[model samples]
Target: MRRGGGGGGRRLPKSSLAPSAASDRTPLLDPHVLHPRNLDLAFSRRDSDAASLCSSRPSSIGTGPSFAAPVTNFSDRASQAAALRVVNAYLAPAVSLRPPLPSAKDIVAAFRCPFKLTRSALKAPGTPHSWPPLLSVLYWLTLLVNSSESGAGGDDSPAASNDLMLYITNSYSLFISGDDDSVASLDEEYSSKARAHAQAAVEASQALEKEALDLESKRTKLTSGPSRLEALQAEKEALTADVEKFEAVVKSWTVKIQEKEESSVHLEKELEAKLMDQQRIAAENEELMKKVDAQVVNVRDVDRMQREIQSVERDNVKLENGNATLEEKGWELEAAVVGKLEEIEGLVEQCNQALRKLKPGIDFQYMLNTKASSPVELLGTSYKTIMKPALNSLADEARRISILKHDESVELEKQSQRNAKILSEKKNHISVCQTKTDEMVARLDSLDVEIGNHVSRCKADARLMKDELEKKDHHLSTVEKESEEFLKISEKKLEDAKRETDEEIQMCARELLKLIDSVTEYKEFMETSISGMRKDLYETVDDISSLASKAASTRQTSAQFVM
Candidate 1:
């Protein structure tokens, strides 16, 4: 039985499996086999002579089912993990069933029979011994037995065990078939093939012999005798003359090629110089652009400074107006204080006049009391009552007036001091403001100077740039002129080279025409020679045919005798 038979027999129902994926479709495998029937029947191993078989051999093993799964897990990591799971599942049982290493005695015992048989077979060589195939069968049987005994069962154990049994049975069948039958069959097949190959080889050899004989006969006929020595001598002389003419033409061509090469070198040098000039011009242009950009930036700065100066001037004007208003307020405060002082002085004079009037009334009352006794007594009482009251009131009025004057004077002095202090503070503030204004003016003037300097510098730089540009322009113009002159020279040289080449080509063409005429003459002579050779060849051919016919008759008779 074939090695694939067991694997091929494991095919489940068609309903459980799908067809293969189309070539263009993304390939996928079923995640789990969904057996429609779920047949739990244990498959018995096919009847054979061997004790056991293993199904690990690669054969017609079914790869479960094809699933039309979507391409969702496209990541390499997912694919790798899936592959690892598959490998682990497949290797698990194999690893579990792996046989332990044999001891030395067991190893010797295991190989002893086969080794002894091999030795005996090698010794008895003429017996047509065969050990390799038998040994392979034995090795497979041993593996089947060991794996079956040691294997730990899993989900796929039944299928694997069935296949293993089938492999063992197949190996047993091979052994039962026997070496004698296999050797006999091989010998018969080899013998038949050898016979056919021998027949073919014999026919090939006979044909090769006939061809060799025919060639020998033709060679003999073709060598009739040497002739036409004088004609060949004449042809050789003509060929030598053509060779000399060709050499002369070749020499002239070499000279012309050298001149053209020299002119090309000169032109190449001129082109390189022109390229360098162009590169330099490009560099100068870039420099000019950089300078222009810098100038634009400087101009922007100058404009910004001018705007700042204008704003500063406006601020100075506002500060000046504020200072003027403050000074006016100070003058008004001083005038109000002076008017209050003058009013205080007028109050002092009015107090003094009231005092003078009170003093006369008191003296008049004392004089009336002294003049009348009983009248004086009564008068004294009246005077004391009335005048005393009037005198006391007058004195109190006088004292209150003096105190008011003193308080007014003290307040006026305090007001004057306060005004003085205020004026001094105002003066100090004005001075500070003036200083700030002066500083601002100075700063404005400095800014103006700076702007003027910047303008002057910009102008100078512009002038410098103009001068540089003019220089570059002059240099470029000179380079252009030089390039033009060089180009003209190159053109002139190219024309000269072309003319020289044309003359050389014409010379070569004339020489070639002469050579062609010579070759035609030589060809005509050779044609005449060939015609004579043809006549001779025809006679030789006739002789060779007669000789070949005689040889064939002799060969046929010999072949018949041999038969």
Candidate 2:
């Protein structure tokens, strides 16, 4: 009997279960079996297909859905990057990281081999060691083992194949029926494309992650700029103190300049008065010179007149001695006139000394700089314009005095009058002092106007400083308002960033939980694999023990025959 169970890639040891060892075994199976229907019925329950081996487990939703980066419970943009990496892993064989060409059973499950031919080969208890279509006979038997004898090979052709292997998959059994070349060519194409896709995806994801980090850094710097403005404001304050100090120094210098300006104006006024006094003195000197000249001439005339009068008196004496009393009267009158002339000559010398003392020397450029209203104007034309009239008036008075002196002398011939000329000169001196007082009053009025102009200039400067201070204060206020606005805007942006970070963190956390569940799934898969391994080992052990019994019987037969 060709007996097989779920064994394709699970080959039995023929050395252990040979027909020689089965001499006492049942002779139900034989070579050249014609009953394909019987074989199909026999192996129907034991068809080893790739689909029948692996079973899938149901999964449920596991841990966190929301997760994020450190700054927020927000998903790092890394989540997207990780997603891309995972996708790449799926697409690439080089990065697949699955086990190496899996053991035969695993390959069977993965490829879903479509054929099971082991049941088609027939075998009997005492059949020859070399059987035709051996694998097919075994596979057919394996398929028909669980069938009823009538249903075993009733209509099934699967039990009639010659050479094929079987697969056990979760949904169905499969049998692979391809040559080595085809399988290898398919594998190569699949692996190559998968690796290519994986590499490209991983590269793109890495690039994107780096870009995200760069953007985050740029945002941080942009946010810091507003605070830097505050630092700049502090610097401005320090500079403002320096500016204030400069302003104070400038103000002090301005005050000094103002005082200097005032002093300069006062000095200029004083210089004008001194120039006027010099001009007045020069006029007086010129008038005095003319008066002295006139007095000298008068004295000379008086001397000549006295000499002629004496001559006349001599002639009169000669005649009057003949008429004696008339000549005596004329001689007495001439003596008084000569005495007045001597006194006038002494006064003229004194006036000459006074004229020298009162003389004004020329002052050049300053005099030219002055306007035509200056006494310098008259001096440049002629001293006569400034002084000749006064000298004439003085001369008139002097001549009048002289005439009166002559009259007085005539009287003094009889009365000897001397105090009359002195009294008249004193009266003229008082009148000249009154004219000087009037000139002084006009100079005081001009000085008062200049002082008023200076006061107005000072008031204007003070107003300008006050306006500047007001403008500075207004600018400071505007800057403060703008700074406040900037701070508000920056704070709002930070709040928004904080909110975004928090959301991303939540998303990332969820994704992290999903990854953890994936790990758990992997562990479950490993555990399931271990359980399947234990089951397979148990099956293998049971198969081994059955073959050992058959082998022991064959050995006993051989021993008995040899003896």
lDDT against the true structure, per candidate, is: 0.54, 0.50
Clashing pairs in 1: 52-168, 53-164, 53-168, 54-164, 55-164, 372-376, 373-376
Q: In model 2, which regions exceed 4 Å deviation?
A: 1-227, 288-563
lDDT at 508 for candidate 1?
37
> After aligning candidate 1 to the native by TM-score, how far in Å is the CA of 5 from where it should be?
75
1-563, model 1: which lDDT tens digit per residue?
21333322222323423333322232123222111111101111222311121221111223422221111121123332443454354445745535687643355356442121233333443331223222322332343343343332212322222323333444555467776575556556656866887899999999999998998898687676445786688889899999999999999999999999999999999999999999999999999988988773677788999999999999999999999999999999989967865664566457556656757365332332323336445234555565667778878889999999999999999999999999999999999999999999999899789867766666666667667556655645554554465455554544444444345445434644564566577778889999999999999999999999999999999999999
Q: Which tens-of-lDDT digit does each residue in 1-563 have in candidate 2?
A: 11322132222223532224233322222121222222222223222221221111111124222211111000122322333343344345554446556543444334333222232233231222212223233332332332233243334443221111111120121125535565665556656866887898999999989998999899898886667778899899999999999999999999999999999999999999999999999999999988888763567788899999899889866875766677778899989967865665566567556655644332211112223455456225544455566556767787899998998778876543356566578778877887787788678678667655655565566566556556655645554454465455545544444454445345434644564566577779989999999999999999999999999999999999999
Return the TM-score for each candidate structure: 0.14, 0.16
Candidate 2's TM-score reads: 0.16
Reference-based TM-score, model 1 = 0.14
**Cα lDDT for residue 26, candidate 1:** 29
